[model samples]
Target chain A: MLGTTFKRIIRAGVVGFFRNAFVSLATMLVMMITLFVIGSLLFMNAALESTLDQVKDKVDINAYFLTTASEEQVLEVKTAVEHLPEVMAVQYISREEALVIFKERHKDDQLTLQALEELDENPLGASLAIRAKDPSQYEIVADFLEGQMAVAEGEQQIIEKVNYHQNKVVIDRLSGLTASIETAGLAFTIFLTVASVMIIFNTIRLAIYTNRDEIEVMQLVGASNWFVRGPYIVEGVLYGFVAGLFTLFLFYPLSIYMSSATESFFGSFNSLVFYTSNFGMLFKYIVGSGVVLGAVSSFLAVRRYLGV
Target chain B: MSDSLIRFDKVSKFYNGGPAALDAVDLDVKHGEFVSIVGHSGAGKSTLLKMILAELYPSEGAVLIDMDDTQHLSKGEVTQLRRKIGTVFQNFRLIDSKTVYENIAFALEVAGMGDEEIEVDVPHVLGLVDLHDKAEHFPKELSGGEQQRVAIARAIVIQPSLLIADEPTGNLDPINTYEVVQILKKINDLGTTVVLTTHNKGVVDSVGGRVVTMDAGKIVRDDSGGQYML
Candidate 1:
């Protein structure tokens, strides 16, 4: 009986949907627009998150050491820095080596010659380029460098200076922007989704209002609530299903374009591959969520306006 | 005949801020009987029919169908009871989106009748209301009388034990009204109980039956052979 009820309702719903082609078409169009915009936003936000993560991976701290620091002391400091556990890689550059590389690389430029000659000696200190396992731990390396005392005979610093301050501000701003985008993206997604539901609900309500005579007659003739509600709920499900599939269709090409455009920056952006690779999972979530939302909107609208 | 196919046990229905729609109403409807409920508007004739169908539960008393108290029936069970009792409305509430055939088949579908049964039964019911040719016509395509006839076909399609028509002729012309009453009498002759509420005196006087007259939500008269008078 339950199975028959299900089949009957589905049949009636489909028939009812076709009976009022204009309203059903209007509902589908509304759903499509709403779902498409939301899907686009989701795709863009995910891409932004991916690119920001890659950018975060590239931020590092460059610490310049005192010029007079001995190679052995510097090696000891390097070993200690490595042992700090946050440090991923440490490259030690000597002052002479730094000068030689600078002169060799910029021999064609007069500014290079003037800047090198003004130093009077190898004014460049041995610098340790420090990369941490995590970008948030850049300050750990900075504080460690500033705290070293005996490397240069207590000249108020074992290192000349760290150039990461300006870079740090940029990275921090970038990170903050990314965080804000993520927060705003989430908020926008929620707000837009709710608005979409409201639109669909009011559309269904109008549809129901137009057919309220039928609803009241159904009630008068002793139709159950399920019987009365079944067709509209099915209408909502159809609206949602078509909308969701339309959204998927719109997302497909956009995801491809997004992936290709971002491939240069983030190495073959394969979100389409990733999202589609899990076809069963992703499709389940999308269709299930769409149908459920549509059905809920219909159920709520009918209950409020045309209770049996 | 059974004493009553429907019985009201001191049924009273109170609205939110006004006097009760039905004030300590006691009523009886016997099997194969055609009872006309006549009253001035707002005199609770509609409320009485609504109670029989269990649309509105009595505020202070109980209503019984076939001697079974309706108060304890679940919502689903009330629906089942309603399937046995058909209702026609003043507005001729035919589904606008559906064709006349679909509207008539709806009642049989509600009863979960087989399609084969519906195929055989729906056309017969429509023919009984003389609307068999307009099966493919939508409600909007039909005239008010034709729409009311579609409503009548829907009510009778399930072969319900009782039929309740509230101002069924309210929207019809004199000819259509006479035709509608003739159809109701035809259904009653087939041994189905018919309870009709109307203010049309000519209808009541022509199709002489039991008459229950009401005034101020109270039953003022009951006669086996009655007229439309308080």
Candidate 2:
């Protein structure tokens, strides 16, 4: 008995979908547009997060030691900074290693290489590169380095200078900008989601309203509320399913095209890989949200007319 | 009342403190009886039928159908009650989108009948209504009498115990009206209790069964074998 009822419900749903093809098509199109906007925002936010992470990785404070400072002293300072809870990583570079790295970096520049080769002995000082857990912690790490030099009052100062002075303003601005952008992105996504839900609700309500006569006839013929309601709910689910498929169709190719365009404009950052790697999870999210939106809207819309 | 298929005891229906649509009245319809309710436009004939079908609740009394109080049935139970009592409106109310065959089959489908049973039963009802040739035709393609026949076919396809026709031939000509009255008489003879509400004197006089005449929501006359007398 249940199976027969299910078959009839499916048949009725299909008939209803086709019987009101224009309204059904309008509903699907609106759903697709909403999903597309949501998908694009999600993808953009994910890409922005990754790019910010890369930028944060490059932010660090460099402390240069005096030429007279012993290698052991520099190493000791590196180890102390590394042990700090706020420090992410600390590396000590000797005077000789710095010169070698300088030469390698400027290998293609003849003027810089000539200037480096003309020096009789290495004038570069040993330095400690300190990275903090967050850009905001860089100031504390720099202060600690300066305090170490101050403690060496009677003897020569172990640390000459910290690069935090040069980079502090830029770092502070970048962190603040990223933080606000993230908060704004989250707020915009939420607003869009709520608007999408309301639009879907109104659309479904209108569709049901157009079919009010049919519903009245069904009730008069002694159709159970569920028997009349089941088919419309099924129709709603189908709208969601089809909208989801269309979103996927439009999203993948658009992501690929945008990825390539961004890579060319921004120099070799392949943003497309993020989409490809997470395609399965994203697909599930879009389809699941569509189904939920469709089902919920239709249920509410049909309930108002089922008072009989 | 114990043997009655439908009983309305002291029934009254008021709308927003205005005059009653159905005044305090007591009536009984026994099993397998053909009862025609005749009245003018606002005599509450339709409201009485609505009460029996559980579409409207009496304001001051109880309506019982098959010994079950309609006012107390759950939503599901109300549907079950309506399934046993098929209703036909003056407008025919055939689903315009459906063919004659599909229109009748829909009633069986609503009753949860299987496709094979519907396939067999729909054709039989269509043949009974003499619309076998118009099986695949939509309601708009049929004449007024033919459309009423389709509505009748839909009502009886599920084999309801009670058939209520509210001016079934309201839109039909004299010939069509006569044909529809004959169909109702034939259906009543087949052991289904029929309640018909109409203002047409010719329709009431032709049935010649038990007639209940009403005026201003009150039944003024009731006869075992009566004609249409206002």
Candidate 3:
């Protein structure tokens, strides 16, 4: 009997799906588009973060010490600033060494050599070149130095302006854009989920409407409401499952292809791997979500319109 | 010897505070008898039939099918009770989506009959309706009379103890109507109680069975060998 019921549900679902072919196709197209948009947005956000991290790896801030500062005081400040947890690295450059390095790098540049020869003495200060764990945290380190005891007093006085300003606005905009993308993606996902369900519900409701006469007949004949409704409910679930499978077939390949593109372009980014290599896992998630959406919407519509 | 298979004792049915659809109606249908309910439209024939099926609960008093008060039965049990009685509608109500074979087979399927039994029984019922050759045809492809027969096939397929047909031949011509009434009589002779509600006065006279007449939600007459008197 269970097997028979299964066959009947499958037969009915197939016929029902094909009976409303245009509408069913429209529903599938809408669902696929929604899933693709949301999926791509998530992938893009991840890629954006990965690319920003790569660029941030190249920039760092330098802190110079006063000639009057004791070596012990500079060492203490270095230790304290390093202990603040945001500092990635601090390389101390002495005044003579800083000047020698600058001259060596600029030796072939006639304009810079001429400028340096005009100076009687090297004006470059002894500095600590500091790399931060995140460029966004550079302000935090700078604030610690100016407000807290993280930097020694004489060294703090000798320190020139922090150079995180150029990247700060760009970093802030990226952060805001990431957040907005995530928020819009979340809202769009929810809206699309609801819309997909409503479409399925309306579709099933049409199927039910076409059979209202038969249902009324069944009811009159003392066929229990279950006897009347069981087949259609089974039919609804079948629609859900087929839609889910179709959704998986479409999105999983798209995910794989997009991930391949990301791999070629970005060179082994974690976001690409996280999004693409987990295609099967995400497909299962989507299929589960689609099935649940289809079934629940169908159930609600059946209960309300069919009233079975 | 009319041993009542169904009894309605002072049954009153009202709809949402309006006037009663069936008011203080007292009636009975005996076992192995073919009873036809005839009156003008709005004479409460359908409402009275619906009460027997427990589709509508009586606002007051009791409805008894085989001495069991249907008023107290839960909805689930009402369904079980309904399985014991078969109903046919004026529209034939054959499931158009199904073939003639499936239309007959569905009743037994819902009743949990084994597939082998359904396969055996569906053909037998279709043969009884004389539509075995058209078993693969959908309801829309059949004539009005054929569709009504399919409806009968589905109802009688379960062999219910009571068959309630509301306007079974409402859309049929005189010949087709006669055919359907003959089928109902034949099923009645097989010991199933038949409760038929119709507006066809000619059918009531020709069937020569008990006639229950109603007017404004009240039974005006119920007599053996009765005619279609209002």
Ranking by DockQ: 2, 1, 3
> Which regions of candidate 3 fall more than 4 Å away from where they truly are?
A1-139, A147-177, A221-230, A237-278, B1-3
lDDT tens per residue, model 3, B1-230: 14788888899888899988888988877788899888889878888888887777789989888888987888777777877887788988877777888878778876767889998999998888898999999888999999999989899999999998999999999999999998998898898999999888888988899998888988888889998886
What is the C-alpha lDDT profile of model 2 across A1-308, one tens digit per residue?
A: 88988888888888878877888899999999888877777777776776777788888889999888889989989988888899998888999999899989988999988987898978789999888888888888988888887964577777888889899998899789878978998999899989888887888889888777767888889888878888888889888888988997787777678888866754435557767887887788777778888888888888889877
lDDT (Cα, tens digit) per residue for candidate 1, span A7-102: 778888999888778888887777777766666555556567677677766787777777777777677778888889788888888777888888
DockQ for each of the predicted structures, in order?
A: 0.58, 0.67, 0.54
Better of 2 and 3 by TM-score: 2
Between 2 and 3, whose lDDT is larger?
2
How large a fraction of the reference contact set does each model reproduce? 0.58, 0.65, 0.56
Ranking of predictions according to TM-score: 2, 1, 3
Give me the TM-scores for chain A across all models, comma-separated.
0.71, 0.84, 0.62
Instruction: Give the best candidate by lDDT.
Output: 2
Which candidate order results from sorting by lDDT in descending order? Answer: 2, 1, 3
**Better structure of 1 and 2 per DockQ:** 2
